[model samples]
Target chain A: MKRKITLKQIAKELDVSISTVSKALRNSVEISEDTRLKVQAFAKLYNYRPNNIALSLKNRKSNTIGIIIPEIVHHFFSKVITGIELVANKRGYNVIVGLSNESFDKEVINMQMLANGSIDGFILSIAKETLQQQDYHHFKETINQGMPIVMFDRVINEIPCDKVIVDDVRGSRKAVEKLINNGCKTIGIITTKDYVSVGKLRTQGYLEALEDHKIEAESSLILKVDDKLLSENHLESLENEISNLFETNPKIDGIFAVNELYAVTAIKVARKFGLEIPKSLQVISFTDGVLSKHSMPSLTTVSQHGQKIGEKAADLLINRLEQEEAIEEGEEVFETVVIETELIERESTK
Target chain B: MKRKITLKQIAKELDVSISTVSKALRNSVEISEDTRLKVQAFAKLYNYRPNNIALSLKNRKSNTIGIIIPEIVHHFFSKVITGIELVANKRGYNVIVGLSNESFDKEVINMQMLANGSIDGFILSIAKETLQQQDYHHFKETINQGMPIVMFDRVINEIPCDKVIVDDVRGSRKAVEKLINNGCKTIGIITTKDYVSVGKLRTQGYLEALEDHKIEAESSLILKVDDKLLSENHLESLENEISNLFETNPKIDGIFAVNELYAVTAIKVARKFGLEIPKSLQVISFTDGVLSKHSMPSLTTVSQHGQKIGEKAADLLINRLEQEEAIEEGEEVFETVVIETELIERESTK
Candidate 1:
């Protein structure tokens, strides 16, 4: 069976704006008879039934914004939602969240479901799977259909939309530099495999920090954990991997983890080895979440300020959605906003 | 400024189903001529222009479910979302989430926005503020309008809908009994005020455990902490309140906290007073979340199995949505499913 065509395809095929195609479909007097007939003939030829026409045709504002994230049980993503809600609610827009669970198919499905008139616009973070697959057609299709999308956190450069991101490279560098300044001779870094955008950037930051300090980076000191470590079933292996890092590198006095879980796990393993924190093994991780604040000795962390990123994303999407002229003209101007991260000191760091 | 008349209000006034009113307004042959004319006359009297008709008239399935929770930056809630997404995606349904931020107004607004043709059904936890106000009209209105709602976790008995909850009282009682079995003489309880259903039930469990053990319950040992303590702004005050409980009850050898935050906070305070966990002060709290597992000494807790609750709630809501026979008959069969909780033993308790 052939895939159902959309107004976007018809508009592109007929060499007319989406709004003009929409008007012609409704036989609006605003469009000339010749243009209306041409658009209608094209739509008919393609068997375009306008499956989601009700979403666009509804005059009453849904006044709700949809946010799609890769995961819900994540510290940074949750904080971003909180921030987005704060701004969206204040501006008379309700926010709905969709979790992709790090699957590319789920991400595309969520966008399609939300874009079908359930929400006025979308604010989202790309899933790890989506980024790795490098398939951005879903995003392009949604944007082409005249729905505003603002991406945050795990965003890709290929998508031409407003984005909010923390400088992962700089944030990681600052965290690693802190460990260096605390008089560490050797430092180990725990991070995800390079397929993840943030993990790659954070690893880069670690490498840059070591080079800046004139310390030769040891490949063995960097442990690239598999993404499966995120699931509960893989936690034991994650702990084992970190333990091997400690056991293999007995001289490693400092560690930097890309996220909170890895950092906390490192501390747990360090304690098992009878190493005292701060005094014996100073550690710093990214994301100042509940685990960071309440862990034993509490964790020294690089706070990505997730809420600020959320607020910035909301502002961009809402601004775009409310601009009638931009919608009419189908403006393609996009922006990438970077929020600053702060390094937090705690008992885990001297 | 007259209040806009909704299909719900018209259905109530006309003593007909919302579907009937919707059909008559659209001049559908599904309604008899006499009934249609009568409905049309009533609608005209109320100046109903059917503002959200597009939402109701569209026969196509949205294939989406909406979930509203009090907060997102919470371990329990996030886990619940994970479970819901797992079940929802497997069932070919997409999930959308809204955060109430524990506010009554936001909760009502979110429901209204989602109900306006955005989602097929809802699985939600009540906002703290909504429970405090005892206002459940939005819930009643949605149910009346032929929408299915499945309440979970922070649910109330007032609403007649499907519910998924853990036996909070029994869970708490088991935790307290474990503390008593560890040979504690005086046990202090840290919980929220009585308005919160979970807190009240957990407190009752604490009392029942003491009563079952033939130990007299001391009113002074019970510290009803303000709910605001959950936020970072009031953490210092929360710490002070728990400290006072410790200072005032010098004989207190065990503690039972209703939530993970309170339990971890108690551990922090107990350490400040030079008290060793499991040896000097045995402790157990409800909800085995991230903080409990990674906290110093690793807390013993009542595991609520949040994922199970989410899965059950989603099943209930989705089942109701897909049952065309039930919708046609306006069936009101409601089931309250109680999930069991487990007592997890850790180093914080003997």
Candidate 2:
């Protein structure tokens, strides 16, 4: 309430060195009992708070982490942010969030802004554009500067860092196996772009599973939609694509949409064609969301365990940050944390 | 290549003031052209960077805003956050996110942490627990300390601040009016705890609409679920509640769920009872999410324009921060923006 007090003033009042006062204020064990007690009392009297940034400069640890997310509007990424914050906050680390807006340039700039002593490390999910570009020199630069990074979903394979990812491939494979088990032989795959590592992995897993079930993977049955084709006018293009796929391969009895949005779209397209779900065209999808639960037949899906993925990713990054000194040389593969994707059989697959 | 140089060190070497160097570094037009050129040459030569945090402190503006969201995993809040970030980032403000995890204490602690010069101001949606408690003295304290707060969605009526909110009452009323127009006499409501301001407003709006249509509002038709019930055994309790509501009020031909989750649940329960959506019982809900889009009949909803709300809130706060003087005194109302809701007529209501 009175004049603002500084560590120098406290040091003078206590007749001790500035470092000793600073150390005592930080609760350092190096300060003696009497000095610590006096310094603590004086600090309490003045309500002294050491400048965090200045202290960080001296210690060379910012105690802050930067997080780059593709989009906060997405439920999956938002859950991941929650997980990261829970762990980071518990460990007394502040988190700075930057949105890439699915742009590579934005993502790079976001990383560059905090690369110099602003943040100790980074935890990120790559933007769709960044995945498409496949240039990870910005991440590499941070690694060269001895900063730890932990990547979650939508990660790049080229960058060497600690990674926390869901077993998308395995999850997709399991979905295909389930479809085959349910007497669905000709499965139609509805997906948007193969640019992402996750997308590629999911597609490959689908193919592998089909092969294992003695079903030849047909390229014509794969109905691919570009990311740009989600707009209003693009709906016609999507409808045409679906119609063409059906025309070419009329035996398709099952459909698997890689993402939930596309899955819902698949359901709509199927309905337009007067396809009776489960009876005529069984529907299965990757990544569970609100839409899947509400879809006409209440979509059967391979749940990605979004919350778990987020929690695990946060745990991995915080764990690495805590053990920064003893961190290993190579990339820490977090087991691809294959949290089993449960088949939530609702009306769609019944 | 030699040693990393700082702004202060460079200022000393060039015999120029630190303020001048800082202004030049930012390319501020306040400095002379020759001096600015010299500062730029030296800064580039030595790779000098003034500490962003320290500079921010000196200017009394951090170019950062603290955002406390209840839960980002929810689509509505996630969309709101995305909107806030889009506007804030474009205006050159970094957003620091904190998840309240729906706890009052955690929310209070986050407010306290950011109050002490950590961020320029705060943008928040009250936690569910906070709404239930209705205590906002901590927020008042921050405001008293000259920190601006812009609250969106879940906001307290008592707190005098800039607020961005959806017209829940009006939206609900219009929804019921539409149901009435569709030939529904008896309407039931499924909602979260009535303690939240939004929930109460929606219920009131429903009552108003029912009265307007000459339909009697019955207490037996309302089902209120608390947080504990929500976290543990929601589906079972909700299912039981819906069955009981229908049994007691068998004449009920319409249902209004105050949120997307409840709306989705209503669709599931309706299907179990062999009731055709929109044909036998017209259904409408608030808070458009992935679930609503995927619900069996594809729900007709009172879409709370979260993106618009978020953008408006961010703009309000940024405007206040950018202007040297206060914009307005006493609760700056953002005019409860009522974005039109579309009735997505699918199998349920069509």
Q: Pick the candidate with the highest TM-score.
A: 2
The pairs that clash in candidate 1 are none
* Candidate 1 lDDT for residue B226: 81
DockQ of each: 0.18, 0.37
What is the C-alpha local distance difference test score of each model?
A: 0.85, 0.77
* A106-180 per-residue lDDT for model 1 (tens digits): 888777666655578899888888787888898987776667789887778877889999999999999999999
| Interface RMSD list for the candidates | 12.0, 4.6
Q: Which CAPRI category fits model 1?
A: incorrect
Best by DockQ: 2
lDDT by residue for model 2 (B1-350), tens: 12246778888988999889989888899999999999999998765655566555466566888999887788888787778888988898878888888889999987766655567888999888877788788798777666778888777767777888887888899888888888887889987677787888889989999998778888999887665534557667877877887788878888988987777677777777777777888889888776776555677888887888888888888987776355445444433434455444444454
lDDT of 1 by residue, B151-260 (tens): 99888898889999999999999999999989999999999988888999999999999999999998999999887435666888988999999899988899999988
Per-residue alpha-carbon lDDT of candidate 2 for residues A14-106, written as tens digits (9 for 90 to 100)? 899899998997889998888899899989876665655455666666677789987876767776777778877787877888888888899
- Root mean square deviation (Cα) for candidate 2: 4.1
Shift of residue B68 alpha carbon in model 2, Å: 0.9
